[model samples]
Target: MTRKDNSVARLYRLAQSARSGQWNLEHDIDWSRRPRLPFWMRRAQARKALSQLYHGEMATSDLCEALLADATEDRYEVRSCLGLQLQDERRHAAAYQRYLEALGGIDPLDDGLQRALTAARHGPFGNLGAMLAYHVVIEGELLRLHGVLAQFVPCPLLRDINRLVGHDEARHVAFGKIYLPEAVQALSDDERRALYAWLEGLWQDAADSALNRRRANLAIATFFRRWLGGGWTRHAKALDSLGLPSATGREQAA
Candidate 1:
């Protein structure tokens, strides 16, 4: 789909990054950093933060599972790369779940987050459709917010966890970086319209999920702006790099 002869080769590097990059959540994180909540302390925000991260990641794990389930041997490089993604997402989910259990217990999914995941799952965004929603839209915003939250979130364990998650997410999003443009290029007109519709719904739910958190105002804004087309010119450029039209520009032209 790319104009360049080495395009798929560049995409192969996604698998390479998955194979060679990443860390073991258990061995890498020192769990002792989990803060002990005192009688006088209300760790409400911290609890919510870790809890939301855990649930969101678990949903991503499900998406990864879908990817794995649909994989075939013919698409060996791409499928194998996705095989690594499945492992990475599960490890991420487990690490965050462990962090939440350490805090107390399951924090449960917010209505908005659940809504987005469900929409992506039950609709045309199946397979590659879901992958774009996950990697391009969701993972892109997550990478940005995690970077900020890593610096600002209070708990040392949560902060470091955010940092670690961000590192892994960068590689996942790297896959998106190489995949989306070509995938978009291959889309039929109707398919592109469907992609835009799915993106609108996904972006809306993403914005809603960040609301009502008093302490996460900055993070919320960052997430919202990303969904609202702020981080998207960068996304548009990724498509342009493929010598294809940007999905956003196409939608506007349509």
Candidate 2:
């Protein structure tokens, strides 16, 4: 594919110029002020919410390391894009941890989460498999969950942080949509089948998560606007571009 026609190449070009930080967790956000949340949206809600965000960011961190290990070092454009994404993931982890601290600390990620992340680090995760899992599926869920959380979040600090991180996530997912198709196209049939198995399990986990359990309790169906609606439909189109039915984009998220 030529530069213009190649989505991943275009993403690399875009990432080169888009490397500027959109917001500083220290200066941009006024950390001195705590959010004035009601009783219901206070500790329990914050704990659940922050814990989710924290784990997600850390998982992305691990996924990035795996990607960097396998990605060609000579092709600095792709590697550079992933490097910037790594910075974003680390920033997100810091922001979430800080937010949790601001709320007097939130619940820790479960042992299951720790185990899963550890297993992923050791497991034979395929090349594009990491991209689709981390950037495509997980990042899409992050955007959706944040959009939903923003609507109900009473704290000004959290809302502002969400707004800033939300911008970063949009760009992150954009990179996934642009890059994954080309990456997956290069994968062998066996690799694609392995990825398919992985996604099937991922969808099942999302369906069973605490967030999905409470999704019915909330009035604001958050996934519709961007993730499940037009945005991810377009995203799924990118996955479909490879003509790999074995690893189709599954429509399930927490």
Best by TM-score: 1
Encode model 1's per-residue lDDT on 1-254: one tens digit a residue: 54554656865777787777778887888887766443544566557756767777877888777766763424666676677888887888888778777767776776776777777777775576677666666666556656655555556776767777776777776766666666676777777666766666676665655554423678657655554555655544544453334456666656
Model 2 whole-model lDDT (C-alpha atoms): 0.65
TM-score of candidate 2 on Cα atoms, chains taken together: 0.75
TM-score of each: 0.77, 0.75
Residues 69-174, candidate 2: write the lDDT tens digits: 8746446667777778778788888888888876687587755445444444454665555566566555665666786677767678888888778777777766
Q: Looking at model 1, which ten-residue stretch has the lowest summed lDDT?
A: 235-244
Residue pairs with colliding backbones in model 1 are none
| Candidate 2, residue 31: lDDT | 86
Off by over 4 Å in 2: 1-5, 71-73, 111-125, 188-194, 209-254
Best by lDDT: 1
